[model samples]
Target: MLSAGNPYVLPSVLVAAGAYLAATLLTDASLLVRIGLLAVLAGVVPIVLNRLLGGGSADEWRDDPIEDPGDGGADADESREA
Candidate 1:
């Protein structure tokens, strides 16, 4: 559930700045080289940072335990059969 208010905001901003720096520093390179370098940084930085920071999945809500509706006998009988 990525949002504007996510905690990753600061790290993402830092990564963007670092990527810009790397891109500028390598300005003498060919267009293809620059594009490739930027692509790699764009792909790797967020993943690495997220892994290091233990950022939960974008779809983490799906992994949450769903509350039973407590429909009474139906759930109870099903559990008893198990």
Candidate 2:
């Protein structure tokens, strides 16, 4: 429906780019520390931004659980039986 995968591509890239730039500022920090900053920022910031900004309709973005109909397929043969 919603183009299959990663509807937040642009926001993700922007967040990642910003993370890279911010991580680069820590020139004296160890590689692992810089990597950790990038990992957390790149992974978490985009989703937070999206939720805070209300980037799209709540229905489109929210992950609500679907309710199953009570009938299921049990009624499929009811008319034929009558």
Best by lDDT: 1
Clashing pairs in 1: none
Error of 1 at 74 (Å): 21
Name the 10 consecutive residues with the lowest summed lDDT in model 1.
1-10
Please give each candidate's TM-score: 0.44, 0.43
Clashes (candidate 2): 0
Clashes of 1: 0
Q: In model 2, which runs have C-alpha deviations exceeding 4 angstroms?
A: 1-12, 18-26, 57-82
In terms of lDDT, the poorest run of 10 residues in model 2 is 1-10
lDDT of each: 0.62, 0.60
Give the CA lDDT, 0 to 100, for residue 80 in model 2. 65
How many pairs collide in each candidate, listed in order? 0, 0
lDDT of 2 by residue, 1-82 (tens): 1121334546666776776777678567777887777666656655665567655544664576575557854676686688
